[model samples]
Target: MTIGKTPPRGETIYWVNGKHPWVSISDMVEYGTILTTKEKVSVNAEKLFGDITPTGTLLMSFKLTVGRTAILSIEAYHNEAIISIYPFIDNEYSARNYLFYILPIIANLGDSKDAIKGKTLNSKSLYNLLTPLPPLKEQKRIVAKIEELFDKLK
Candidate 1:
């Protein structure tokens, strides 16, 4: 996915104070869920950013904070710090819940470079990060088991 260009500061107020939720890296959580966000974008901003990320799209932050992941429960737009993953084919084999659980583990395997600023995972490195996928039934079972355990913990 291509990163959206940042709107100039002066124009941001108008472009972001509208109906669409605008997500930044700050909106992501290690727990693999995003409940809400503080920023929003106008339709024009959405146009500039390309398509709205659909509900249940998995989001991962690869820069700065590095390993944060989340699943959007609502339609939203996100900044460059995050990349949205949409499962277009074989939905049964690619469950969003399962991916959410797996992304943080993948992030740890990413190639990290220590620059003058901070640790970052370049797009190429991120693309090359390996992920394990089980059979569709197993994936669903894992997700269900995770939920069950979490519910117990709660």
Candidate 2:
């Protein structure tokens, strides 16, 4: 997991039709896939402000309105409120799939004192959260089961 980067608050980052999709908090969709972003920034702006989050990475918002998760369908840059989550393991796809499903729990583990407007988790809280990591096969099973139940919801 890595935090996304952003330009300064007043910077000129958005363009009418820029070279990179710039995913911000407003662009996120709960348990949805981001094929394209509503906003774009220049290539130079992306180079200066953020790194490219490759396709298939999971993103979760951590500031203001927390707990929204989205799968990246295109290579893009994101704002600081979002974090890129992808596994660095041999079974990359499986591990990431597991994390994507469990992110809502992690997002809600914030302190209760700030529950009125929803809790915002800082980087410290985010990294400190304990997540269950079963074996690769088990994770795949869990993902499959989750998808099965989700399909039933439709």
lDDT of each: 0.75, 0.80
Residue range 1-154, candidate 2, lDDT tens digits: 8888776656655454488898987787778889888778876676576568899889988877777888999999998879998677737589888888887776777542364565678878887777888998999999999999999999
The lDDT of model 1 is 0.75
Consecutive 10-residue window with the lowest summed lDDT within model 2: 110-119
Candidate 1 residue lDDT tens string, 1-154: 4443555558865465578887888777676567787777777775577778878778887778777878788888888778877655546535667877787778877898776667778889887988777877888899889889989998
Please give the TM-score that candidate 2 achieves against the real structure.
Answer: 0.87
Best lDDT among the predictions, by candidate number? 2
